[model samples]
Target chain A: MEPTNERHLLEALASGDRRAAERLVDETYRQVFASLVRLTGGDTEAAADLTQETYRKAWKSLPSFRRRSQLTTWLYRIAYNTFLNSIRRPVLLQPIDEQQAVAIEDPDPDQAAKLQQRDVAERLRRAVIGLPEPLRFTISARFWGELAVEEIARQEQVTGAAIRKRLKLATSRLREALGEDAI
Target chain B: MTQPTDREVKSLLTEVEIPEPPADLAARIKSEIPADLSSGRFEGTDLEVFDAPRRSPSRGWLIAASLVVAVGGGLIALRQMDQFQTPAGALESGVVASEAAASDAVAPESVQYRSPVDQSLDDAELETVLVEEIQLNEPLETRSSMEAKPDDSRLQEKSTPGPDVTSADKVVVDEVTAGQAELDEVSADRDRSDRTRVDQKTVASQDLPSPATRKVERSEPAPSRGPQPKLETPSEQPQPEAPGEQQTRARQRADSTGAFEKRQAAQPPQAPATVESTAVAAPAPVRESARLEDGAADRSFAGARAGSALAGSALADSALAGSVLAGSYQQVRSALSEGRWPAPEAIRRAEIVLGFGFGGPEAESKQESASPADRFTILVDELVEILERRQATESELEHLLRRSRALATELDGQPAVEELVVWIEQIGALVESAEER
Candidate 1:
């Protein structure tokens, strides 16, 4: 779906239109904070941070809206960067070059069975957090951002085949973690 | 437990919901945004919404920079041309000829040329000049008379007694006596000529002279024996200022500026008679003392050769110090990353100091050779090491990594290199897949 007129929204806010700015703040706050919480995994301080930061960023950036992607897409990208930053891990945005694809076979043969027993919520969060960055990114774009696989493929600049492959692998891992409890 | 069916897994992951943040989050975000906006810190706003474009210079900036460099360089080259400025009158004709000769080196200057004498200035070179056909009025003089002379000198015994040898020896003796006498006459002339040269320099400065003016200059007319002149001194050698003191009075003087005008003036400048002075006053014969002077000159040249050795030693010291500091900083950074180390600034400071490295092999050599530099480095290294140890409070990072590695090894059984890589990749994909959902 085409993104809404983010530039129009920003221009209204810049001119001291409290109503317009308030409406933007109200609309974006829930999704932004939820996304942060989802990314940080129940870290309350971080969730609140991610929420405030998104709105702040949106407000500040509203005036220069060249209207490329929808304003919401930008906010999502910022939230993702913030989450990636907070985790303080490595390899957040690695691309799947051909050489990399061949290497992505399962690392451990035996751990899948045992990982199925952990608390579903915690396990899901940790597993996703521990997952390789590319797969993790694909799943997050689809879930918290509510983007379709096609939308994600377009956003991630990857082939539709690659997106599906990542999704299949991620789902299997989640299943191994959640098992019978999930359904 | 196995990999869940796609439909079931996707459904569960989709069901996973993030709770709403506190109400204050919206207010906080709202306030910070406007301040960032009106502050004019950001160039363009919502454009960054999609992506933060990498900061890079525009083509115009690069073009402007190139123009600046070109103009600046041209100006410098023009200014440097001023020192060898060609005079406006007859001097310009000679300068043009010289320039033509210079260009002639490349061929195609059409001037009828005689055999080209290589005019490149080496250590020993003299310029071309023409002299007028005037007779020099001079006479011979001598010092020792027949009364004080020894009847049979040791040098006389070594002389060949053939008829031709006697005639040749008499001619040589006569020339020697005449030359020595002329040098004596010019002893006072040396001082007077120097004053004239100085006066000429003052005159030359006022009006630019023609190129045709004779430049009958000698690179070395006077033997130098003073410390002041150095390369410009023309001729300098150490002469003992005092009998026992190490001080050698080395005096050097250049041809005073007005040398051209004075030589070209109505009174032609007199060339001093060449005198090979063999009468070195001495108390006792010391072969080593003469060698000592030669050795001093050798030492001056040796200083040039020794330059690289000294620089190499310094580089090695710096590298050694650098590695030591780098090792320490890396340890500290790893510590900081894991939260086992505190005080990032202090660690950063320590790293900066440590970066130069403590006393390694290079430092040790430097310690011996350049003690002051090495000592300063050593003190800083010691300080960094002390600070690093203190700031790196907890020591569990290594242990944690070991545990992580061990668990990783046990879980995966440390497959073959390629297999292990594949497994890591697959696990990575799984992990990433989970995160995405």
Candidate 2:
């Protein structure tokens, strides 16, 4: 189903369409969870749990939506919102000084093992989660899910230009985070 | 074809291949939807029902049979006795017994109730005060004598959950949940090992022998399809399609890269401190005003008072919270009505000094110390202060609004002030209308 004209999907999802709801999950879960995992810097387990929870919330909240945006945008919004909700509990990120990063280097004899410890993608994830908010969220919205400027604007209740500007600043900050040469 | 230009590749990232969800996820998601939609009944209330302890099917049949037999017996008895006695007397007595049973059922409703303390004022007095205060948020709250009414420390927790918890609470909670406990002697031996995940995989992936002892492999996936596949090399990351898409795609990659960049090489710690600090605002225009959905705000405000700040009795009755909000909102409105703008510096001083005395985001960081509303007040105060300092004519202020614009640009994300900027500009139009008159 192209979900684009799947008004029935939405209606069914709204009126308790199990398959439509399943389709919604099948379509969006990977993107949503991957985006969240990226935003959260590879906390795979948390991302998985949050992904499931997002679907639950999205299903319950499907009726409340007044067709403000495409269902996909709404689903992404739900994912971000669920992630925010899950981390609301006290046990979240630790302070920089106190949190000792598990040493990246392993004295293991295998070359692959040593290389994986120094994996670039994983290192990049660490940098992303370290950024301050607003910037961090903006970056995630832009890169991970690749949401459009207007979609992000509507999700955040701001203008497209505003999101564009934030996206720009966020990029500059990302360059700074990733290192000048890395960009 | 030669590798596409950075701009070409940047565009493709937008259409980056988002992998399919793990198979079980769709099933899990499908199981969570509810068909019923009437939220008025569910929002703040859960269904309460009496589950009569289950009776066996045999017991049910036995009860039905007994009832039938008793009814037949009663009819027979009535037929025998009614031939001689007055049937009207029996009917009246039966009616009386039913009335007694009915009264027993209704007794709880009439058990007699004491009027609450606030009830003494009645509909007239309370509504009148609420009507007047509806315009002003509250005055008593600002009074020094009131001593900054102790906020229900837990209000943030109670109010929509997000705005309730403190930084310290967040940190402490994280520590409790994520901290490693003492391991057994056999497991402790693994601490000497370079990586731990292999052990978890070994335990979970029982097919692998000595998985815990196996070292992690760290090589990039083969760059077969899509854009650049490696991490540090931004050129390698997939780009979105189209020329105009360059700006957003590059911006997104830059952001993604920035998050992974770390100073010390180790992962950022798991704590509330980091989470709050990194709670990214949405990518949108921000203004220098604290805008909120009134309903959400009102709910949260009342929420702020409950265990967040109120006694159970006061919270049990929403009327009390509404009265408090009414009373305070009126005071703020009245003060504004009286043309009292608290010193512009007061907000900054309150934030800087109080924020330092209390732990804030940090002295230098750009993140807000208070919630968006409090931060917007600061920005609005700045706008007002900038206008005060310029002493420019409306046209001049419009020109001098260069200052407001500059500040707005610097703040970058205050949606309220950004919206107000349009209104402020519209005021320029209003000024021209006045000049025409």
TM-scores, in order shown?
Answer: 0.34, 0.30
The best candidate in terms of DockQ: 1
Candidate 2 CAPRI category: incorrect
Give lDDT for model 1. Answer: 0.41
Candidate 2 overall lDDT versus native = 0.40
For B1-437, candidate 2 gives per-residue lDDT tens digits of 23334343234323333444466766665555454532312222111221136779999899999999999999988875652143223323332333334234432111111111111123444444332221111111121111111233322211222232344334433332222121111112222221232233225323322211221211112111112221121122232111112222221111211111111122234311231221112111010001111122223335334332222222223233223322332332222223343333332221121111110111232354453334434444444454334222565545534544443344342222333343234334334444567
lDDT of 1 at B74: 93
Evaluated on CA atoms against the true complex, candidate 1 attains a DockQ of 0.20
Model 2 has fnat of 0.28
* Candidate 2 Cα errors over 4 Å, as ranges: A1-3, A88-123, A130-133, A180-183, B1-21, B35-437
